[model samples]
Target: MTAVGAPQERAELAPLVTEPERPAPARRSPRRRGRMASWLLYAALAAVTVAFVYPFVWLVSASFKPRSEVFDNKLIPDTFTLDNYVQVWHEAPMALWLLNTVIVTVLATAAVTVSSAMVAWGFSYFRFRGRGPLFGLVLATMMLPGAVTMIPTYLIWNSLGQVGTLTPLWAQNLFGSAFYIFLLRQFFLGLPRELFEAARMDGANQWQVFTRIALPLTRPALVVTALFEFQAAWTDLMRPLIYLRDSSTFTIPRGLKAMLDQFGFGGEWHWEIVVTASVIATVPMIVLFFLGQRHFVEGIATTGSKG
Candidate 1:
């Protein structure tokens, strides 16, 4: 009986002993192929970067070379000189041309920015009769070819006595751009309605709400719109050619054309001078783009995300 009791007690103690918890299997790291794929992607991107940048590098190199070597496919010139720059200045009124470009770009960009913002605010915030039709008309303008309206616009400006001057260049801003207005209106529509309601409840007028709340929140859109306007105005050739008759008022592109005409591709073409002028014309835009790149990226990203 004593042996039987001992055996039973041993059996009960064996049942109380539990197994320890096993650790989870370690997760396998990502495959080597994935890492190789990432490296290959980076290599492809680097090649593409070089392809885009090499042309500009060649342009600068060509600008420094003498006319005899301007067409050489060399990455670096054996000789470099500033004579081309001096000739460019002497041959044309580049200084005045640049100044005129600056004025037109600045004024047009400002007008477009302010007017677009105001129009966007109204379209986004207001509700009225024919509102849908008006907005639809604005969208329709974007579809119309700018060239189609060129003659009509010229006629209207001519009738208003604004032709042959800078007025026509900027007067279009009063109506605001269809594209920019739509861009900004989309941005405004993304804003919290409660904020506008709160402003109104606080006795804020529509103008005050726009000035204080809407404008501040929509800064990215404004910057992008302004940048676009600036670039357009800066590089515009047709408007200036049609409106400006005086050589003194020539913008950079027009002035460059005149320089090329003097050089006469038929004989003794000063390729160096032409290339140098091209470099100079492009430098300011490059600087502006790089300086504002951060804002541009932010603005475009947010606009797309919100819209």
Candidate 2:
């Protein structure tokens, strides 16, 4: 009788062993949220990239499109034509303009790099009276708008009989630029002082120390400065407009402007030709940037770190 009662009690308890029925909470996992956020961020970046890159793509496509399709907003043209480039080459003195640009840009870049680096070395290594104040003054000059002194600068160049020449355009940079001086000074300051001291101990004169020790170590900075100044001279329009009087002396920027001015915007618009000229003019600068890009980044990083 005891055995039978124990079996009956065990069977009754088995039915109550199951859990109460309830719904599970619908919360997202952390990994799921993170993945969603990453996707959103990528989407935003892609949109911004498209916005900036679309214009350049359109410009290149327009250069290849027929005149009737030049103004179209499509990235792929309905009809492609090389006549625009052909006309640009025939109608404009692009070769002469490119040659002039090359001369001015190279000269200006070399001069500015040398002058600015020398000035920067002085500011970094030499301890002189009012040195800080003088550097401050140089930086202050950068704050003033170019327009404020444009007329006075033009008049001064006119007095020197260089107003209608590329000499006036590049002469100012050869003296040194405030911004370039600042950039090079930061890089020079970051260099190892012990090396410079050792060179001096070995009877190295100031010029010798500068040329042999400092310059070789600061190659990255120099390349960056040269690239910057090169691009500045390459794209300068106002300076060329003010200085270059003869058509033969016009730089690429000035020549392109002349083409636009000659062809009024309307039914007679020469959009395709102008775009073609622009594409040709832009290639050199792009190539230069890519070639010096590694040094450029290193220089910026070195200067920024020390600053």
lDDT tens per residue, model 1, 176-274: 898899989998998998999999999999899999999999987888899878888888888988888788878888877777766747365777877
**Judged by lDDT against the true structure, how good is candidate 2?**
0.85
* Best-performing candidate as measured by TM-score: 2
Lowest lDDT block of 10, candidate 1: 19-28
What lDDT would each prediction earn against the true structure? 0.83, 0.85
Q: Could you tally the backbone clashes for each prediction? A: 0, 0
**Error of model 1, residue 251, in angstroms:** 1.1
C-alpha lDDT of candidate 1 relative to the true structure = 0.83
Q: Can you give the lDDT of residue 262 in candidate 1?
A: 67
